[model samples]
Target: MAGGGIDTRVSHRAASYEYKVTRYLIFSCIVGAVGGALFGYDLGVSGGVTSMDDFLVKFFPLVYERKHSHLKETDYCKYDNQILTLFTSSLYFAALVITFAASHLTRKKGRKASIIVGALSFLVGAIINASAQNIAMLIIGRILLGAGIGFGNQAVPLYLSEMSPAKIRGAVNQLFQFTTCAGILVANLINYFTDKVHPHGWRISLGLAALPAILMLIGGIVCPETPNSLVEQGKLEEARRVLKRVRGTDNVEAEFQDLIDASKEAQAVKDPFRNLLKRKYRPQFVIGALCIPAFQQLTGNNSILFYAPVIFQTLGFGSSSSLISSLVSSSALIVGTLVSMALVDRFGRRGFFIEAGSEMIVYMVAVAAVLAKYFGHGEELSIPIAAILVAAIFLFVFAYGRSWGPLGWLVPSELFPLEIRSSAQSVVVCVNMIFTALVAQLFLASLCHLKYGIFLLFACLIVIMCTVVYFFLPETKRVPIEEIYLLFENHWFWKNYVGQRHQDTLAEPEKLGESKPAHA
Candidate 1:
């Protein structure tokens, strides 16, 4: 009868519960979405800023002539391709360093504080980049921006996931992706307008990223902390009040009770770092931290966006024309993210990821083959091939928006036990940022050095990513929040020893379910 009551209660909760998305919740998500915009703006900013030959030649004349300190005015007309590449790619290294450390900082402070730190840093970085008189100062600003990105990358997703209901969790969580595409669009438009309006146009382009940072900082000042974080800190009453405010009075007690259970599990765990190594929690950690985001990067989708101008220009489009084509790809990403918000809950996580990954692998191969054929033959890209390249990039961004982009944030929040959720999630995010930074830096350097071989390298990485997703990642689309504990019970579930372990765990189930998992 008690078990039946629990079932009936869940059904009632599902049937009658109407999420009154409070003003606070909506405001908070919009604020959190700004972080995503900053991400897009920063990535796109470098491509536009560095493309201005006049700006590059003026700002870093030594970049072109290390030996000739006083070159004639006519020397400015010559383009130094290598220095241009360096100017474009330097930001990624800073991103790499910040990503590794953001996890620790978020764990030490709450998500809100960490985000505040990132926002302030981004503001300062933008100023530095805008005022930079030398290449060294510009590099410093990019590093600062990267650190801000690292913090935003970890905190915003954690914030969105904690605040949303399970029914719309996938859609709400994907707000980050949608806003990220929004940021990209904003940056492209800014680039297009600024490039047309001013000779020192790149300064406005670089500085415009500051708007989102300012909004994020102001928003974090008033936003409420995650209920789970509040509960974990033993502020039970405070957690309850927040739940009531965010979730409405329809199920406040049950929600508060769920938070209490999660707090207990969190309290039971002695050490977060060690908890990740334990058999029960390790699988989700690996899947979230290592596998999912890794696959997202290996998709080669970023390569197109990050290097769009150069890549297209190499294929025969003029600088102005390539930026226009890049805008089309950016627009597709926003459209695709909106589609993902609608479908992630309806179609489920497993199908989207597997299908998107498979399709992207084919697109990447075609892109590489086409590029290799043209670049190798010393032939300029014809209109048909250029159109194909643009379409291929569009498909790549579209597929990414639906799959790994948003699920990257959703899975980590859902997969972990309450005890180590924040810390573990932070670690995973940090690792992801580290790799994001590393990949961005290496990609730029590789393009300068390896040329066409760069695509082949990413192609290999994508193959490894495909194998991991097919075998390891589980479907978490409609599973209740509390039930995610099942996926964590055995690290070997992805192995051939699954049925035996299931029997063993079921025979002594009490030890595992002694406490309920947290309400994320």
Candidate 2:
């Protein structure tokens, strides 16, 4: 199903897109990246809210009872109620469905429109969540929040990639992950403080989600549209001006021409989703849209991030200590994103994947082993053992931050050609959200039944996913977004499908890496 002895280690670099990171470029990227914080705030806030005595008592009293009455429940099953889980998972379900609409909006209305829509929807959701009096209102608010996340996630990374120069695409696109981490860290800090605010503390935690939504909304209004999307919309003159402004140079001919060429190819396809099934695109579909997003969740990092406070509480930490622990892990996550941004282009994507995957596997297994040997149901872990577990988790998150955490968004954002970019991103977000929902929905039950075995399962998944990366995924660092197909066409395994029947329908028969005519 893979390489027939074709070398897959080759990495390609195109001539640099003329760029100097001007004010408008930075502003546009910052705005798009801030959208990631909307997502991050929710991720960080939910777990803490769930762990709050006030929230659990209001929405899930049985769970609230279980949390206090340790002897009556097992270590992992304390929060196993599906209704409670649905409070978190329902958002992802909503996000999963809205992704299709976001794809159309991104293509028809431009990426900026989708971001603004997402921000407004998220703000509405946050307000509703803050004022909710019943489970139905809560679920509805979460779904709205998910709608915002779906649209925001679909467009932001693509916006960053399109706006950035090839040389720093990895670093630039990672602004999404960086902001996401910042949101999570900020949320955790807020939760730590809000958790003490008596009966209304949980409402405060959920309500604060509106801050990032407003930030992104403000940023989206002032940021310029991406040159690639502008080109696709046939705004050639305006695209020219934006290109010059963003690049800080008038010599943007090569980059602008490439955008035009890719836009023409994009224009040829009316049904990008249907065209996505063609044999030549099989490689991108399988790797970029499917496997990468799937592997990202199977790494089990999101599951951890989603329930960090709960996981800590289940492991016997006091409520405040659990929030502190989540804060610590999230801090590690931020550090990891910064490291990835600094080193990703220098080291390339593949090396980070394999190396960080190994690191993750080791830590996951260590956590599992420690839990199996030292942690028991209804038992308090010694302070030393508890410290070790937190340390292991911190290191694991650190590894994820540098690897799948950011690359999951970065690689796929740059993987597709302009023609199927929106459609491909839709697939990517849908896969990601569905898996996220599944993990959030089932993790407590899995924890109940599998206990320490859950960590081992993640460790095993890491091994399998890393193997797929080394064998199947090509190195795309420094490759101009439009020229990314070259890496696939030259790859050991992917070349089989990428150069298949799809090329016959194109305007020109130039091999993938060659420059096509701007008019073609």
Candidate 3:
């Protein structure tokens, strides 16, 4: 009877342990999603804020008067383009600075702590922006807001990647992007209703971002620090405890030892930055630093996202119709991103880029062609032409959201080695911000001058991007984080042909030999 009781207690305890680990994993993902939501809200709200009638009247009176005053819309287009650019680009400028700071903070203070700091900065920025009475104050708020975004964006994915099991890492890491789309959708929905709020509607839209920021702060406070980060800090015992809870088993000793080995290998590099200059690391540095950011921004998604309402208005929709159309476009983004989250792990990252890149090139050309034909006819576009323009825009956004939008972040997060991961990612994020700022700064002016030519230019850039993906980008699906270096070292053709097979062989117990047990 006593033996039976002991067996029953053991089974019950095993079930409870499994439940606790699952609960912790879910909660951690939710926390990371909160950070992502903040990023999306910021991106989504700006378009509405800039488009709001009251906001224009209060802050951008000159541009607002192009329609209401004696000047023609085309005549007044030259005015306030620079200032308007400043307003939108300022956040990214601040983000660039914070991306550097985030690297040190993530390394020194731990990922959770950095995220908390970001949340606090974001909350403060939201309050400032909400209460701003002048353009300067608003820009200040945006700067603070950018700082928060920088920290959270860098830390959250790193945290998630460190904690997730290898089999589910892609799906889990994708939660960051998924939540980003959700936040954007939420922001647009809020703006759609608040559009009628008259004097303070834009304020409401910008201010509401505070809610998710606060939630991120609370969540960051409560969640366990990632075991890898703890190992980096030499908190081995604490790391073990975290791994036990997060992994749901006492079998974490092997994983913990792997972390120790990786950390030691990382620490052995005397000067990490200089080491990147070596031949071995240069390719990844170039890919992470230059190619990824170029692909992300040169595609022109930021321009579309930041000026969706304006783009629709340019396509001959009224103010309300433009806002509504932007909402629909954002919805497509959400849906496409959801599909990406489902397939990114299964189909492989490089394949999506190839497929989506081709689609994007096609859609961009179609958009350019339609706009050229319509504008060539006159300022007044027929209903049929306008419908075609909108369709092209939606399809273009759908392809982009599924492909580059999420993978832009995911690929870089997985590509670099552990030693240089934070620093390299920061550099990538900084470059991404710089490109984003450049596009935002130039978008309105380019739209005014280039017209359909701008779309064609982006299409040309996409052709280049697709070529780069085919020749350069490696297939990183389900590749273990520690072995990512091997992917980079192989010739591009080898990675294309035998990379998965190589990874499969490496994953085999006999092939991996001693390390196999650790991974298992």
Best by lDDT: 2
Total clashing pairs for each candidate: 0, 0, 0
lDDT of 1 at 464: 79
Judged by whole-model lDDT over C-alpha atoms, candidate 3 comes out at: 0.78
Question: Residue by residue across 350-468, what tens digits does model 1's lDDT show?
Answer: 66777777777777777778777765343457888888878887887788777877776666677765567666766666566656655555565565466656667766776777667
TM-score of each: 0.84, 0.90, 0.88
Residue 95 of model 2, lDDT score: 95
Summarize candidate 3's per-residue lDDT along 118-169 as a digit string, tens digits. Answer: 9999999999999989999899999999999989988998888888865567
lDDT measured at residue 21 in model 1 versus the true structure, 0 to 100: 78
Candidate 2 overall lDDT versus native: 0.84
* lDDT score at residue 520, model 2, on the 0-100 scale: 20
* Candidate 2 Cα misplacement greater than 4 A, ranges: 1-18, 250-254, 479-490, 495-520
**Candidate 1 backbone clash number:** 0
- RMSD per candidate (Å) reads 6.3, 5.9, 7.8
lDDT of 1 at 489: 40
